[model samples]
Target: MNRIMRESRKLRSWEEMKKIILQRGSSGKDVLAPIDEVFGRKFSVIVDEMPPYISLRNGFTGYIADIWQIISSELNVSAEFQKHSFDAGKELIKNGSVDLLITPVIITTTDIDEIDFSIPIVKIWYELFMKSSDDGATSMSYIVTWSRNLWFAFLLTICILTATLWIIVNIRLRLERNRGKTPPAWQTRLDFWRGYRRWAKGPEPENTLKNELVSVSSVGSSFLFVLGALTNQGNCLKLNSPSIRTATLVTLFFGLLMYNAYSSVLISRLAVGRTTLPFPSLESVAEAKTHIICVRRYSFAYVQFKQREEDKELLEKWQGLVNEPPCLNTTSVRDVAAALCYDNTLILETPNIVAKIIEDYNRSNGCDITRLYGHYARATATVLMKKHFRYRHHFNKMYYFFFYFFSFFSMMINAMLHGGKNFERGTRS
Candidate 1:
């Protein structure tokens, strides 16, 4: 490449070309460097098909894209857009398939070795999302509870077990009137009622009920004990049989845990006034009680955070939290908002995606989303270019100094040119 460049430079007077550029500056066609003039019909870029950024339909609606159009017009060069992925654009820059990438890709430490990036174009902020309260036409008005399907399943299970217990006890009853035994049918029925009453009320059956009978069937007591324990308001029903007592103790322990969980979830939801509760911060999200099915693309705060900050405690905590897979991995950030479409889910993504979602939902129910945590870890998206490209410094200077820094001046000049053209057209008519 050096040999070819030397041969090329020999043909053109490099000194004279430099003098012309110095006089005219970037404002005139004479300022085009030998490198710029080499094969330049139009300076085209490999545009990644990220809508609002670069697309056939949107053309270049994003702020950075608008800025690019301004720069292109200033240089008196037409920009031809070619669509490609970020990876493809990087590869193109490496092999010189394209001059540069127009789409703004976030500048990360990992990318530094491969390609040089232009001056930071747009400042980006990270955001999170949860389902809106007004998700449906009629918002959910019920207290926090498990889904109806779960309740149905539990009821079905209980019914089947209770029926089986009744059948078994009836079949096992023995009627032996010869040895001071009552008729099996009457005795089994009486015992079941007495035992169940004892369990539902208390071991002091006389106090729980005005009248009491001597309990016989331990099976009835066991069944009633399990049911009452589930509500955490069980009677002090102690079984004489060791197995029955042990089972009762076990059920009570599990019931205590379940009831506590249920009550806390209901109370918290009531306080929040929504099924989904607001988290204190991004870190608090990890410990949030709401079991939301989160979804995200690669452009997420957690990914950036884990990659950059090496705080062992934080990394370890986040790593372990995501192990349960808080958010489903997606290829596009737009799809991350799907998490917010559901009942209990969240998305950790950039503000661009959040704005897009809100725009789509504007006329309808309106996005019930809130920022909650922050515009944390402010970042910049930049244009990707070949490492040590001849025009890197010029491109940076063009935006930071000429185009972006003098944006107000450029806008006025553009408006004046547009107004003059319209007036000329009117005069021609």
Candidate 2:
């Protein structure tokens, strides 16, 4: 009788639990039910050797691995990570052979229909990387020492000075001729007007205004004098008028200041060994038909180049160059770095990934890589899963909760440390 009572009680307890579960399910309040269904199940995770995201060092360790650990722990699921290239991993996921892909998969329009992505874990942008070369002090350096506006101002000053000198000399000569004084030996010489007379006189009289007025040769001589002063090359022209002497003095001083400044800057630049990039902008890179444009195969960089509409012609040109001889399809960061270092290649990758590559490769290869300043493309990276993943909602929910919690925690720690340092500094002061 006691055994029958115990059996009845056990049946009642099971029935009550079943009724509770049914009610929760009907009301859509059983959030953990799906999780419970898949609890303790092992999932096959596909991963690639993407550093700081999914690395093989020490066996399945990186920021993405950490996130997976948190999500899997909350869901009570185990993951068996399999190493493969990003392309191979996508293939495996498509075939339903892998439950998840944990690399830093960038969300792009091209692949959105083919796969499902979790909430974005990180934002990234594409930057250009190229080999650093020491072609120091290029021929254009002297011209670039002064900006276009400055150079324009300098030329204007020269023209103004030349006109002033020419006018003063002409006025002085007119005064002397009016006083009935004989022309100076230098002034009487025909060489000053020789070319002008031949071009303008043909057979005209000598006393014509065109002849008596300052010859075109005088204008040329004035220009040459001003240019020579600015360049610190003294001229042999003689001036007698006080006004002409005063103008010459001003020109000499202006030239002195400009010449000194230009020389100092040029010398410092040459001494410092400043280097300039052959392709400084995206437009320049596109125009460079001889150089190869390299990017990881099947990466977002490749997708961006093909899909960008603003520079369609440039993209087409880049594609054509990439398809040509000696252009490599880089598959990894290391490969990109190697191409940048050895080949005439321009690599497109995210700033952080490029940083990692440069940091690793520059140490051994002597700092042969550099990243361009501005980014041309942007993307968000997320974990990839098979389309119609059953546990996606739960996984995303837990992932977001943990991610924000940890982010908040880190911010607080940083604030506290920064406040303490400020307090210490105040006390010291």
Candidate 3:
């Protein structure tokens, strides 16, 4: 009982000492080093397999490795490196097998329960990966121009209805039935409108005729009405039935709206040709029926899909893409990106990571990854540490030091080393 109390007292005193050390650590005292050295302890960092960010094999090497080297140097301590896969790294950090993670992990809700993160080390953008543009105009070009499949259905309904009208008019003509007089040969536009106005107001009854010519004239009127709504022309023949006129008005209304929408979209697309931009969005991806190749599970791309529980269509696409043997290599994301060099590929990945992959790729293949959308660019990604990590404050202080002073320099140096791939942060396509 006495020993238990004494041990508890020791734990309290250690916590008090840690608090004091953290206070001094941030105040430019380098106080953490003395404690770490006195305890003969170092942080173990689990590094994941992202090159140009953190490459861990025989030893740590990459942008993150260089940064960690500087941080360790400044802290007057060394971090032991343990190379692991991304999921394994997360599990290792969560279970306290490691005190730190060299891999830059995105801060997520799931992570909140398992680990603590330093202040953001870097910001990464999300991208919608898609295939190279194809120049051919398809029968589906109306999709881009109309922006909805319902419009196509509506137009098709109009065509079918018009054809039915034509057939009915032909049958009536063959039966030699007519109840209206034919228009004068030299009738003006005003005369046609005058006659239509009378018909809609319930025209006076007159002598009926059973004639094939009247049926032919009705067929001509049906064609005229269809042409006026679908194109820039109007039918002059007045329909006698109230129901038929209402249906014609419905067709005209839809036709007017569709014509305006289609014309505007078509002109814009023509201005910026399809070759310049194909598959502008996920909807386009579905319409184009392009193959989906995802890099890894729990990646930012999948995270976005998970967040969009309401988007049933996109969710379905995501599920379908996952059901195969290595639509992508599950281990290395870079390998999936490298696959883009040959296969028609659209892959969702963090922009900075793939930008490096593309840089390395273009050196040999002269290929490029097309970005259709940028997601999660503002998400905070930081170094992961074990849950309730004793030295979180200490590491956070060190991270802030690097973030303010070295952050800009690191980005500049990277951009200089590789040509400028500096895209604006957080802009969605």
lDDT of each: 0.54, 0.66, 0.59
Best by lDDT: 2
Global fold similarity of model 1 (TM-score): 0.48
> Could you tell me every candidate's TM-score relative to the true structure?
0.48, 0.62, 0.49
Rank list by lDDT: 2, 3, 1
lDDT of 3 at 274: 55
- Give the clashing residue pairs of candidate 1, or none: 294-327
Off by over 4 Å in 3: 1-41, 57-59, 131-274, 286-289, 307-314, 322-326, 329-331, 342-344, 359-368, 373-379, 407-429
Once fitted onto the true fold, the runs of candidate 2 whose alpha carbons sit more than 4 angstroms away are: 1-43, 59-78, 105-110, 137-140, 143-157, 160-225, 228-268, 307-316, 361-367, 391-429
Question: Residue-wise lDDT of candidate 1 within 292-339, one digit each (tens)?
Answer: 434332343545546463332335545444423434455454445445
lDDT of 2: 0.66
Alpha-carbon RMSD to native, per candidate: 21.5, 15.4, 15.0
What digit string (tens of lDDT, one per residue) describes model 2 on residues 1-429?
A: 223222223333433333333223223365455556667888888888777666687887777778777557655689887888888888877777778887775546656667887888777787777776653478877877777899999889898999988887787668655654444777757566874565586653344332333452288888888988898897545544467668778888999999999999888877876555566666787786657777775566665566452332435556666524444556776676666664566777787777666665553554556556677666567788888778777677656655544543433343344544443343344
Give the candidates in order of TM-score, highest first.
Answer: 2, 3, 1
Q: Candidate 2 has which clashing residue pairs, if any?
A: none
